[model samples]
Target: MKKLFLSTITIFILIACSSAPTKKDEIKTVKVNAAIGEIEGLIEEDVYLFKGIPFAQPPVGELRWKAPRKLAPVSETIKAFSHKSKCTQPKENEFILDRGVTEGGEDCLYLNIFVPKGNVDISKNNYPIMFWIHGGSNIWGTGNSYDFSKLAESQKVVVITINYRLGPMGWFSSSHLRNTSEGDDRSSNFGHLDIIAALEWVQENGNSFGGDPTNVTIFGESAGGHNVLVLLATKKARGLFHKAISQSGYVSSFSEQFASEESELSSAKVFQDDIRFLTEDQQIADYLRDMPIKEVFQRYKQADESHLYSISPISIRDDIVIPKEGIYKALEDVDPSVVVVAGTNKDELNLWYLRSKYFYQTALNLGRNLKRSEENLKSWIKYRSNIWRFTGAEEPLRRMSKSNQNLYSFRFDWDEEASTILGDYPLFLGAAHGLEIPFISGDYSLVPAYARPLVFPNESKEGREYLSNLMMQYWANIAKYGDPNTFVQDHRWNKFRIQNQNYLRLDSPEYIQMVNDPVDADEMLKTLESDSTLELKERCLIGWIAEMNFVEEMRGDPPFDFCSEYTSIDLLKLRRLTEGRD
Candidate 1:
């Protein structure tokens, strides 16, 4: 009689559970077993957010300047609702700091995950994952700075953003820090290693969060895009990701001094000398490893702005993570099956020129009158953008296609009704380098202070919303399947081929179409040369520097080999002027 009563109670419980409502079941809270512990995340409306989830052991103390280590599993639960401290980076502009944000810290190897409501069944359903890497020239910026809720909810996908080491902390190479006793004692590019570790964590934990680990897509813009290429070329990252999208990605090579070998003036050497001068010569590595965060930050800040670009942050071709011949040279070795979408904006360089206080000062010097300065700046901006698209986008895509890899190219030309602080925004900042980021992520708050008011005004709300939705769909669609055409029913985003040189000209609400034989760089340069008001040599060097993110590529061979007249001094002057120290 007692056994019969227990069986009846069990049956009643099962029946109640089966009959419960399932549609949009209110998920006030959610839980998932991730890397370190069982994470308790919050469910607000239709989105479930898990922020500040640690993926690796803190690279502090002895681990400083070393590869990340696996984080041991814990029995405790983690309340992952708030963002952790960002990785150590320089203080941002005043507008950014006014938000009461502190500078980055060393213990910042966390990631944020966003999952839509209906796709939270790890036991059965499989949702696509988009891993994001933030871009700030690899010097500054954090993954937590972005909000991926809209993109995740609108398209049933799992979105992730991560924080990796930055600046000297990320890419510094030191002879003392190299593992001399090991089989291979190469150092530098710890940031890249951190990214690899993060992806590995995803591979292990993605399924627990209702994501298809096998269908992961890595996408980034600018520096982040560059990293995507690095991962693409990396042998260890071969099976880690299936697809990649590099927005306004530039190809660059690092020097032996920055990566493999030591130089008299390398970042490592300079810091070592400073430490010895302050403390002592013995145990340089120990002293550096144990140095106070304040002192290290001070030394890092003392580095010359010019040297930071020209001498530092170049990844060493250790033949382990990155090859000896740089990414472009190493691309032939990457798996041909990996689908790639690479492209740049119509006016990538305009953002730099418009944002530069130095450029504004130069315009004042040249104009002697406000209107004249603005005109010359506009003309110069257009000239620079054209050359940028040619060398950075069109040429690289054409060259990469020779490797027989599946690739597509695009040029974002949507600069409709963008009038900001500079006045006449359309002509000045049309489809700038980072403009596509806000559109794709549906987070307009990431838009810069100056451009925010003008580009996203109350009147143009409809257009902005339309463009954001469309771009997000394209991006999410690509992440879901190998092709973006599977999502958009109205228009087919043609696969970029060397034969036709086809590309999608992304505009919104009315004008997004495919075109061939875009702008000609040589012709644009000729026009700039004829303009007696403009300084031809400075214009050429400025355009080149702008294309390469203010860093002049001095390794291997000269970038603009066609332009023979510009001297090293001319390039130096351009750099100083751009930095506003001149």
Candidate 2:
């Protein structure tokens, strides 16, 4: 569930001030701080955790859709014990964030923290700090989902989780919102600004909580992972995070026109052009900002459930924040000094293709409502664009995916059918998208089987232990040394290399493989990405060409069944070159 609160005020001192460095905080439950204003905290052994503590003032009323400002200082300590209520949204919204109307208020700009118990000399101790940004397509998810107390207690590091606005509340970008200050082009990405503010708060106050602000690792999954990239490239977020980890996050592929005016105007234009009819054909620009929030969302939802098409803007690259729209530029163009660990799951686009309601509709050939079907497919294909996502920039994207290859190239294959098929008819989830979360967070009970074994009996006991150890090892490795490798790694860590397309296969008992790379992953992707791109069938043709020699028996044979004669062996080699640094 997505949450929206950011700060809480409550006072609880689990580890007495007089105590020197000890193991755990004496108290077992959460402790809200009076200094930071009552934020909630929980004790999982020796660590005290505060969940949903606000770092900035909520963006509502006058603050609605504005860049988040520093949190207002209160004279009294606020209670920070429970999960801050989230904003209003539907249950189906899985951008990974949710704001239940009843859950939170406009004042929800909080962050969560975990402090090790009975520790003194905390500053010089240099305990690594991990700041987690949750992924939910930028519109769903809060920071409280994963409890970081164990990580804090075991590693003796400070771990923090934070909330940023979502949907129109968070990522509605454009050059629309005027800066109360002069000549500010940051109008479009206020939500991103909110994240930056939270980081700033950490830098300033981490020491007070006995954390080393200097050694910070900013990481997240999906949209949160994407934000890490955004922060990586943005001049604003530079140095705020010394290291970064992006899991299952890819570059936002939007045309120049789409990236021009903050993303919201694109939505506005789409609304004016088509969505007006639903609301008696109101002008998109005139009505969107003024209409009741429910009506505005209702009108947009009615027209199309997919937020990308017609109106919703994806990633905006103005001079201020995002210097470039894609991660390719960030890696190739930015300084290598900015260390990163970027990896994708085994089936990167599986969720885009499989989870799409459009695919289900197409598969069943159900003559559902045309508008609804069209809207659903529009959204589906947009993410899973045969050209944009797969063919058009496939090779380049793959190259980008493998750009930081020297770093750990991990593929999380933890399978859970129940969670993936939350509401789907076909319940076969083979290492689906976002499956890495439970593994990384060690949340095995993610599915009905694990959470409630009666319905999902397959949440085996072995699986739980495997997931728990895997997540802890991976996180601890990165948090300890910016490197995702451990001294006791069960499997040997592999780097992205040209000759061997090796990725650390993270399954029960570690294994590795030097199999064939996606031969047409780039060329087909490039072709499909062109303004005048190839059709899906055309892509299949090109894909067939690339895979000509990409057979399992002949792993390195560039001339396998999928590749056409017109395709060159050099292209495959080029792909290898791009995938591997040397």
TM-score of each: 0.83, 0.68
Name the TM-score of candidate 1.
0.83
User: Highest lDDT among the candidates is held by which one?
Assistant: 1
lDDT score at residue 275, model 2, on the 0-100 scale: 48
Each prediction's number of clashing residue pairs: 0, 80
Instruction: List the global CA lDDT of all models.
Output: 0.67, 0.51
